[model samples]
Target chain A: MEIVIVSLLNGLVYGMLLFMLASGLTLIFSMMGVLNFAHASVWMLGAYFAYEVSRFIGFLPALIIAPLLCAAVGAAIEVWGLRRVHHNGHVAELLFTFGLVFIIQRSVQMIWGMLPMPYRVPAALDFPLFTIYGANFPAYRGFMLFISALMLLAIWLMLKKTRIGLIIQGALTHPNMVSSLGHNVPLVFTTVFAGGCGLAGLAGVIGGNYLVTESSMADAMGPIVFVVVVFGGLGSLGGCFIASILMGMIQTFAVVIDASIGDVLKPIGIALSSETLLGEILTVPMARIGPLLPYLLMVFILLFRPRGLMGTRDT
Target chain B: MSTTLRAGAMPAPRSSLVGPIFRIFLIFALCMALPWLFYNYTTGRHSGFMLTMFSQMGMMAIFALSYNMLMGQAGLLSFGHAVFFGLGGYFCIHLLTAAGGGSLPVPLEILPLIAGLCSMLVAIVFGYMATRQRATAFAMITMGIGELVATAAVMFHAFFGGEGGVSSDRMIDRSLFGLTYSQGVQVYYLIVAWSFISILAMLYLTTTPLGRMANACRDNYERAQFMGYDPKFVRFIQFALSGLFAGIAGGLSAITYEIVTFDSVSGALSANALLMVFIGGTNAFGGPILGAVLITLMQSGVSLISNSWLVYVGVLFIGMVTFAPAGLAGLIAMHSPLQQAGRLKPLIVPYIRIVVPGLVTLIGFVGVVELLSFKTIGAAQGKKLVLFGNPIDATTAQPWLIVTGMFLLGGLWLWREGRWFHTLWEAMMADLKPKKGAAQ
Candidate 1:
């Protein structure tokens, strides 16, 4: 029971982190019709920036300033890089970003070296925030939760209240109508691109410390974020949120359940050995197959629901 | 729309046999002769570098052409193409090892065929799932499937041999001739022969009824359906055939390297396929061939000189995507319009003007990149800044001033020269208009 509670909590936190990354990707993909292959690289940049800034000042200021810097970089990429390739097509745009991934990854290695940085949680948030079922939840996790919630509220409020946000909302559904109505669609694209990159940077700021500030962290986290966006469906933040939590729960819970399908089958009057492929597949423990869950979910979703669970657009 | 974009203009419908037949013989002679020329002249005994590079070119030639069958001819952008290539290699290695163990009595000459068949089977299963969707969804699904196989290759110890991978002996006793396949040159010949065969087969495929239908489906699936054809089926078959050729390439790789790893089937190689196809120019049948050769050359040559090879490739790819989607072949073919009108002489001065400034700009840009890389990366690694065989300090202001000055002046000059080049090109195009109209 304690394990279940702890896993749920961990899952929620991880899901929120996944949400932070996936939200930006989904927003950019839906509005622009181009999947930014360098989105995770931008997330990685956030972590590196925060680490650098934190060394000079503190984590607090780093968190605030790192995303702004990311925004600036994103603006340049959109205005100078993506705008030039805009005439070609979406495939060209995707390829351009794909190229950016290699450049960013190599550049990151060149700048930071191949070693992981020593970015850590602040001393103030290092202790336990509370005890839940004999488990101590760290204050840093509480802080992460607070920040994500604040971001969620902020995004929701902005979309509901602001003129630009309303325009973005309109573009999300009826891009042609929005364009025909005399709104500067290109400007919107640049703004959205920058804003999305800023969100990714924000994710990197916290996620880097929570995980590890390493060059390899981007590659590791990139696919999972993609899986989340695909599973949640594009053009639906609510769906993205739900998918993120579900995936997080599935991953965390899968790691704990060590019993194999053989054990489960033994109780149901079926005796199966690990001699055959099916039996072997069934015999593998849940813990061993934990990493495969997200991919399995993605394939299943793609085969059944091409548009995803709540997606208004097809991938 | 998809099918028509590729098949609307099929070059010329008359006298195809005479023209292609002559070209094929010429290509065949060139393919057979280049190796001997290189063997006698360049890097012949230079620590097996040239031999290895030649063999890589052969395998990549086959690989890139197969990739073009999808992107260029069929308009299917796959991100997991290396799956077949890698699997074919693994299967070949396993067969070779088994042959060495005396259990399998198969001859070494037919090893690639067996591998190709196996890969084709695998492609049939995977392609069924991948070809169901089109465009972005298709690319993403292939990515997912690719990651799945890559993960499994590491996890399952049954056939994959885990992280260590599997190795095989290549000097098999089973050969068509009485010669022992021990020397690197012998393997090179084998690769050359197979590459030629695969190229011929793929080219023949492009001229077939299925190939035409595949082009139709690529350009306009609706029109294909109206003509009583299934787009999905055409894609599936084409995908399977592509896998067959890719399998042959992988088999050659296995023969050359004598080992197969998960890296063979990784996303990086798949990206290489995309890069080779896109950068070589997908509009031409020989685009990926050019891309494969140039990329292989760059892989061998540029990588030896600089560590920032990926940055160069990335920049090139993005530049190609933005400015020249048709790739190197398109840039070359851009002159065809001028050639047909007999007005090529007028553009000579304009070309020279651009080339001079272009060279200057390249030198300046390359200098800045090398200097920055040296300061940040080389310094930490205790490597000296070496350019033109001379050691220099990167922190010096004189070098920085020269670099900036050259870059700024060259850039400005190039811009002005570019305007002139454009004006000349536009005038040339205008001059050719009357001729084109008269011919039509």
Candidate 2:
């Protein structure tokens, strides 16, 4: 019962964080019709920025400032850089963002050097919030959950209630009609891009402290983010949310277990020696296969359900 | 926004001169002479540096050119082309190992071809599934498939051999021509020969009916369908054929290195192919060759000085896409009018103006890169970081100031001269065009 409860809470926290990162990427991908390969780089920058800010100021101020700076960077890149390549078509746009990935990664390395930043949680939030069956649930993780929840609510309110939000929604579903309605489509794009980067930054600020804030964090997170985006389907925030949570749970749960195909086959009277390929496959633990699950799910989704679970349109 | 021009409509037929028979002879000549040229003129048999580089170039040329067949002609963007190349290498190594054990009857020289064919077989399955979609969906599918395969390559030990990867003895079985294929130069020549034959075959493929239809489908699928061409079939065939060439490249790699690893099939290799194809200019048949050679040279040369070379490549790539959408081939094609009118000589002054600033910028950039990389990777390796026999500390203010100054000066000069160069280029081109009435 304790193991189950712990996994469930961890999964929720992990899922929420994935949602924060994937939501921004989904919005940008849906609106622009270009998968921003540099999205994870933006997340990495947020963490680096937060770390730098925290060194000079308090953690609270750093969190707010870092995300805003990321938004500004995103706006500048969209307005000045991506806009120029938009007319060249999709491949060119993808290539442009792909180029930005290298630049941003190297620039981060140059600025921060190659060492991992020690961005610790604030003392106030460092202690355990509670104990579940004698297992301590750290207060920092609880704070992360709260912050992500707040973000989710804020995004929901903005999307449903605000005028700009409504415009963004209309543009997302029907871009041609939004333009015909005299809306500044370019302005909408800039705003959406900024918002997406800001969200990615928020995830970075929170996750950087939660996880290891290393130079290779971006590369590690990049493929998973891409898997989420592709698995959730392009242009579907709801699908993105679902896919993020599912992936988070899959990864979290897969790590905790030690069962293998051999164990599953044991009851069926199928025994294998260590001499064969099948034996090797059967004996590998679930912990060892944790990294393979996301990719396997992604391939299965692309092959069987091209549109994804909650996706409204095909990518 | 500029109006979309429907440029690609129909594919051109085969070239009249240098038919398949002549091309085959040319390939043979080029291959046989390559090893002799490398051995006699340059460093002979000392770890086979020239031969190794040549073999690498040949393989990559095939890989990049094959990738272009999908991107340029078929209008399909694949992020997983390394899958075929890596698979080809793995199979070739496996075959070589089997032949060494006397389980297989194939000669070492023909093993690469077998690998290429095996890659084509895998391509048929992957291509059939992948060609079902178009555009973004197609790209996503390819990425997913690539990731799946890559993960499996690391996961399974039977075929992929896990992280340490698979290695085999290249000196396997009897030689086809009654000579032991044991030397670096011999293997290099074999790869070159196979590369030439593969490229010629690829070139021939583009002139066939299937290739023409691929162009037709790429330009307008609806129109192609109206003309009784199946775009799906066209894409499938092209994808398979491209895989075949990529596999040949892979086989050459396997034969040369005698090993294949997860890195061989990684996303980086796929990205490299994309970079090469785009840089070379996708439209021309020989464009990928130029891209492959330039990229390989840069990889060998520039990477020795800087770890941040990828950043420069990325920036150049983005700039290329935004400014010259058609690529280096397209840029060269743009100058054809001036060359045809014999007014190319007049533009030399303007070209030098631009080039001088460009050279300054490049020097500044490379210097900064070398300095930074020397501080990091070099320092970690415990190598003395020196410039002209003077040890320089990266933390020092002097080096920083010098780099900043060079960057500023070079950038300002280039910005000022680039516009003047552009205007002069236009004027020269206008002057070069023949009089309309006289031409008629």
Q: How much DockQ does model 1 earn? A: 0.55
DockQ, candidate 2, vs. native dimer = 0.55
- lDDT scores of the candidates, listed in order: 0.86, 0.83
- Residue B7, candidate 2: Cα error in Å is 25
**Model 2 quality (TM-score):** 0.93
Indicate the residue-level lDDT of B44 in model 2.
Answer: 40
- Taking the tens digit of each residue's C-alpha lDDT, what string does model 2 give over B1-440? 01111233344554542675585577568756766664553544534666777778889999998999999989898989999999999989999999889999988888888998999999999898888877877787787778767877898888789998999988774788765667877777787778788877887877766777778788898898776666777788899989988998998899899889998898888889999999888898778887898888778766665566777887777778888878788889888877777767877887788888787777667667657766655666676666545677877879767766777898899989987877777776566555745688
**Residues A107-157, model 1: lDDT tens digits:** 887778777999999898899999998889999998998998899899899
Q: Once superposed on the true structure, which residue ranges of model 1 sit more than 4 Å away at CA?
A: A262-284, B1-21, B38-47
User: Which residue runs does candidate 2 get wrong by more than 4 Å?
Assistant: A269-283, B1-12, B16-47, B374-377, B386-393, B427-440
Model 1, residue B353: what's the lDDT? 93
The residue-by-residue lDDT of candidate 1 on B197-246, one tens digit each, is 89888877888766888889888988988876778878888999999999
Fnat of each prediction, in sequence: 0.50, 0.52
